[model samples]
Target: MSDNDNRGDKPQGPDNGGNGGGGSNPWMKSLLIWVGILLALAIFVTMFDGRAATTGGNTIAYSAFLDKVDEGTVKDVNISRDMISGTLSSGEKFKAYPIPDSTLVPKLRDKGVAISAKPEEGPSMLMLLLYQSLPFLLFLGIAFFVLKQMQKNSGSGAMGFGKSRAKMLTQKEGKVTFADVAGIDEAREELEEIVEFLKDPTKFARLGGKIPKGALLVGSPGTGKTLLARAIAGEAGVPFFTISGSDFVEMFVGVGASRVRDMFEQAKKSAPCIVFIDEIDAVGRHRGAGLGNGNDEREQTLNQLLVEMDGFEANEGIIIIAATNRPDVLDPALLRPGRFDRQVVVPRPDIEGRIKILEVHMKKVPLAPDVDARVIARGTPGFSGADLANLVNEAALTGARKGKRLVAMAEFEEAKDKVMMGAERRSMVMTDDEKRMTAYHEAGHAVVAMHEHASDPIHKATIIPRGRALGMVMRLPERDSYSYHRDKMYANLAVSMGGRVAEEVIFGYDKVSSGASGDIQYATGLARDMVTRWGMSDKVGPLEYGEPEGESFLGYSSSRPSRMSNATAQLIDDEIKRIVEGGLDRAKQVLSEHIDQLHTVAGALLEYETLTGDEIKKLIAGEDMDRPVPGAKVSSVPKAGTSIPKTRRPNGPFGSPTPLGA
Candidate 1:
């Protein structure tokens, strides 16, 4: 946590016992206000009652008061309309209400009792008005107090719906610099010129090279677009106005436009500043794309933004930086030459980039000496900067969970499995038969992938239930691969069919479970893509076919009216079937030829519930998999005898495939 966050947790008490300037504690202030209001009401009641001053005397009945007067015991009486106050001859004070009799007054005189007549004065009209309006005034005070608090907390008052929600980011929130950014060097380089323009615009203008008025950051999610913007702000050391695109939208027609005007007005006052609008696609989407008449609140806001960005008046010294993952949906006017002139693409990091990202995140973690960034980077092919950061975090969490002092490479491996495959489901229970079937199924995939020359090396195989799968076998490339060859595609198809083929060969065809549903879906998609998209099938010709209408990643593909006609559709299906069937036959032949080795791998999985590629290779070569693995400080090596000596890859057991015909 930051120091600001920590300071908020402690009390304001100090040696002087004064309230600290950081006064977010509202309850105390509210209590004082209420206490003052209550005291004022108390004083008002005391001043209005008048009877409170005469509260010391005892109250008596009217008959007793007259009797006292008749007995000449009453001294002097202060008589009002219905009540009388007096002191007895005994010198004690009393009050009473008397009957309305004219003769009583004369009788009082005969008794020599002193009588003073004064009618009780009712409250004045002004006092009555005050009494009636007090509750309403109290209610108004409460409402005003609430509104003031709202303004203080939200910066936007209760009705400030059209105010700009942009905030000026500063170093207090931990300023981000270019040194803190990694894994996307090209994107960083693209934005460095903007920082230069902000710092010294004359250097560029001397050569008649005007800096871009706006730069649009286009990238996939988690590709570090927003982080790059922050780095630019830190480098420039100028004012930065940051707001989300959603902040410029409202239900009212002109409210969004009003906010746009306000935001630009604020930006103009702080010239030479960068205004970053993240996810600009929210308000900058295509104007006429909607089903409505096309002029909506969002379009109006977009129109105002376009005019402000590149209107008749040049916004000199002010640069606009916007980011979006869906740049395809943005309006053309927003991306035209003068508005967002330069478009920068921030792609996912490559292997080298991943290594740099890992190093950056590793500084904050206590990593073991054996933790190699290259090894983790090679294991992760398509990971973005955000993903690499999460990998490091998950590794730390795994180490903490295991009660380890430092995060080790083993913890990273487990974290990789979690991020790539899914978390392990330890709570899932399986019967003995189910466990055996899963072991055999995964063993088939591992064995087939090991025997395929073009397929990637097997990383690990497990019968442990994870994610939605009862068992899974993962493969990782020796290095990142950008393109695929025909042999590699064929190998993938064959490897995908290994699990189903194993069940058919070991058990009966009827007993083969639905465990290979995912494999079938993957194979079908690859087959169709090979025939239609990649032009791999000569029978289907080199024509591009449109997307299959109702295809899902996990479900089968369905055909509909698309770019191809009915006859061409039937031919495409034929080519897909042929490719898939060929792969099926290849997997079946390989598994049948190595039936004994398949049992050995399956038996190991049944015993260990999981096995690495190196262990599987050892098991296939008749070596003891129970021996110490690589990188372990072992005193000795285990011996093994093999009927056929084999040369295997040292780190991973792959790249040696026997020809099917041979």
Candidate 2:
């Protein structure tokens, strides 16, 4: 309680001391108003006090007064050394002042006028007191008001520096219940018991079962960890305090710790509440990972958090829920029992979960009859709930752009393409040679992917530029897969190398463009991983040689791996090069076997600019389709009005190719 609050309770009627915790403080307002009035009064008295007193009389010149005295018109008189005053027989009171002659007083006496000397007086004690003290008091009041205003505007004062900045949500505020969150059933179920504990502890307390003090939600970005926390609070219908881990950390040495203490204190007041800390890895990183001395603020904050959790009784009803993607870097103590006792892993949603997530996000969108959530879910193997939501929003935007009333399957496909391969750069102009090369390159990828035993089915092939790629071939899985086998790895590498192989087969190796640079990098990484990490290399055996990343807060580098024997290192390099060479060989053989099909697909791409998996599969199956060839002379130089194959655009409905590798 504040000191002013204590004063408010003291029987001081109508003076709440500005501390009563409700509406505006009437007593403070009244006090301020009176201060303003007193200051104004002091100013008025200060300005007007030194002037001569004026009342009920007209003043005459000294000569006129002397003449009046000679005329015997003056009856009674009062005199001072510098000025004189008198009452005339005509019943008028007047004063004549600044008289240099001393004969005036005696003359008034000779005229039979009652005369007396008026005594000199100093300013009264009230005026003197106001003059001396009112200015100081006014200055003090203005300064105090300004400081108070500054404190209010800044949301804190020097004394309140240790207060927690966590935003408090009562039961009514955060209404995001479990029904609002989908795609993470396991995480939701894990937290359901926590909510039950908050709702009523006696059921568990009778069995001597103490509620877990904390649960850490670990997941990748956009995996809905924060949303899960909010749902728990909503289900429990209790007060909720949400704060970020970075909020606790400050430049001041003990500020973070102070905030932790203050936050705990607030939780205790609103007992049975949930305190959620998002992105806890910011402040919960491993201690001593900083500079030589380590970070005092974050460490201190973590220590205080540990103490707070340890001090809480089993039935305290305060649950600390935190979320972090980098759980590996968090301090061990933070993950130990009694503090973050349960670490719930929130993984990306699988196919079914993705379908449910899409359904939930689709509630607000006007989806067309053709839009199938299941089909989209099957295509999006690694989408999180947030990603699904974004996909639906993107689809809706695509539909709106085309002036459509409903979001259709075609729009969803375009949105998915935008999400995966990136937006198509239709404005980018490609030369005739580049266009032809891109068509052959992408067709090569489609053909190789179709033949690869472990590859997913081709969805679509396009020569239209997407993102940084000159062209792209999308291969989407029918269902999500958790692991890859050796054949699958080999197939992936071969598919990655197909573009360059196609270029080498069609045009000589010298004619191949640098467009295959990304493919080579991806294939090399895969090959290296197979040799060093996956144990696919027969010479390197099943040994894992990849170094784990270091977990230092200051981003300190780790020492190199123990040096391998020269022969062993050379063997590993040779195995990686051999794997890449094998993939290139596989791609070349596949392209050579189906040279006719490759040209056919490339011709179709040059004509349509895009082909669905069904269309490509039909063409590959030897269906005689009308295929357009790039640079095929129509009449020597084509007429200006003649249709250029690459210039023809896809219909406006989708306007972009879908993600499918035929």
Best by TM-score: 1
Model 1: what TM-score? 0.82
lDDT of 2 by residue, 390-509 (tens): 888899999999999999999999998888777999999998778888887888888888898788788778888877778888777787788978887788878887888776656554
**Pairs of colliding residues, candidate 2:** 458-660, 458-661, 458-662, 459-660, 459-661, 460-660, 474-660, 474-661
Cα lDDT of model 1 by residue, 1-662, tens digit: 00000000001111211112344567788889889889868867876686667545889998888888888899988888767888999999999877778888888889888888786678899988988888788888888888987876555775777788777766555667899888889889888878987788899889998878899999887788888888887798888888889988888898889898888888889887889998999999877766578678999999999988999978877788999989877888999989998999988888899899889889999989999999999888877787888888999999999999999999999999888777999898998778877877887787788788888887788888877888888888888677978898888888888888776656555667988888888888888888888888888778788575432434544455445788999998998988887777777767766766777787778777789888988877778777643321111211121111121224653233433211
Lowest summed-lDDT stretch of 10 residues in model 2?
1-10
Model 2 lDDT vs. the true structure?
A: 0.76
| Poorest lDDT segment (10 consecutive residues) of candidate 1 | 1-10
Off by over 4 Å in 2: 1-155, 171-174, 311-315, 552-560, 624-662
> Which candidate's lDDT is highest?
1
For every model shown, what is its TM-score relative to the native structure?
0.82, 0.76
User: Each model's C-alpha lDDT?
Assistant: 0.78, 0.76
Residue pairs with colliding backbones in model 1 are: none
